[model samples]
Target: MTFYAFAKRIVSPILKKMYRVEVKGLEHFPEQGGVLLCSNHIDNMDPPILGVTCPRPISFMAKAELFNVPILSGIIKKLNAFPVKRGGNDREALRTGLKVLKEGKVLGLFPEGTRSKTGKLGKGLAGAGYFALRTNAQVIPCAIIGSYRIFQKVKVIYGKPIDMSELREKKASPEEATNLIMTHIQQLLNENR
Candidate 1:
């Protein structure tokens, strides 16, 4: 069996029992492409949940520190997670993300950059926007409500794929593209509420 399938088979049942996650909009997920799934960062479980819940395999840029853990490093790597340097512009991480997408895989990203300990969404970082525009990939804004509390009801809503073709055609600045992407994410959150 494929490693992803194995991992998902193991993780999905546990998460489902503990969190009771409700996911909507599976239809919006593109069948194939360099797609970006942009989500808010609220809880540590967010990444793993996305990996399990999404229809396609999801590759994410995890904090480099996790990779330093002896056993965890090997496990997450096998699960299709890669490390990104925490503090600055991580070019290597960006390149790796591009490579993942270029191979027509789904690249999952957290627009807020870090976990919102307060559960309040923060300004979207430029990375998701910049990457979507640069790669001409479709951005699907996702909202996870009440995921911070374990063993509670969590709702994950997937918005339609965002078309940012103009950004690529115009060669927009990363900051500008990022702002647009953040807006879409914000809209999704607002719509859910």
Candidate 2:
């Protein structure tokens, strides 16, 4: 196994035991090939939690600032995470994400753009939708609950992939497409709650 795979194998179990995580719909994840895992952001722990629990290597677009920290950057890189600027146009980050997908690897995205302090979902960003439309990749909608609460057993629900073919012909704008994606994510979160 690769270093990351080996590290994940070792670290994942430890994290599960430490956090007492409960994940549902893991079978919903694609058994193979490149896929986009879109989820709602609740806290900083969301990415690692999803990463450790999921069966595949999920590379996420982390803020550029995090990568500037020497120690944290090393850890983030080992976890298959990449850097993206918070504000302004981050074309490089988008390009990097696309490259990962092109290499047939999974890419995890938070459509909300940032963490939700209230544990409530936020409006979706167009990057995820654009990626889906451009690559024709399967968009797996995911919901993470109770992650905002410390010492709580967190729950993660993975919904069936959203078919982009249906929306491919629609006249909706990028923003509209993003909203549609968020709506589906919200539905899954609501149903689970």
Candidate 3:
């Protein structure tokens, strides 16, 4: 098995026992085709929680600074995580995301761009919307509820694909599309949390 699967195997049980991570609406994930998993960022464990809970393997983008650490860089790389420059336009990172989508893989992204200190949803960046507009991939809105305290009941809920048919023609800007995506995520958070 690949390292991604291997890591998930080891991490899954630990997350469950320690955090009691529960997932819902997994049917929203398509068995095949490219999919963009857009989620709210709350804690550092969010990515791994989503990864182990989701049915499919996810390729995620990490801040480029994380890649500078020796052992961490190697591990994240093997886990299908790529580096993305945070503050400015990183064309290479965008290109890598497009390539993943084109190959019909799942790309997990935190549209908010960073973890929220308040544990609330934040403004979304345009990257997720940009990918949806550039590809045929479906955008699934995900929300992770509960703090990452040990023995806490954390939940990961996946919502249905956001309809991007209207924006696919470039009629709407990426920021506008991001608003729609964030709206869906907020709804999920409100209902589930």
Candidate 1 lDDT tens digits, 1-193? 9898998999899997789888888999999988888898888889888887899999888999999999999988988889988768999999999998888899998977899878878877778876887685778888888854678888788889877877778888878877876777777778776
Best by lDDT: 3
How many residue pairs clash per model? 0, 0, 0
Error of 2 at 8 (Å): 1.5
- Candidate 1: worst-modelled 10 consecutive residues by lDDT: 146-155
Could you tell me every candidate's TM-score relative to the true structure?
Answer: 0.94, 0.93, 0.98
* Local accuracy of candidate 2 as per-residue lDDT tens digits, 134-174: 67567899998885454568888888888777677775566
lDDT of 3 by residue, 1-193 (tens): 9998999999899998899888899988899999999999999998889989999999999999999999999999999999999999999999999999999999999999999989889999999889988999999999999988999899999999998998987578889989999999999999997
Model 1 lDDT, full chain set: 0.84
Cα miss at 132, model 1 (Å)?
0.8
Question: Which candidate model has the greater lDDT, 1 or 3?
Answer: 3
Q: After superposition, how far is residue 185 of candidate 3 from its true place, in Å?
A: 0.3
Global lDDT scores for all candidate models: 0.84, 0.84, 0.93
* Model 3: residues with Cα > 4 Å off, grouped in runs: none
For residue 99, what is the lDDT in candidate 3? 97
Q: What TM value does model 3 have?
A: 0.98
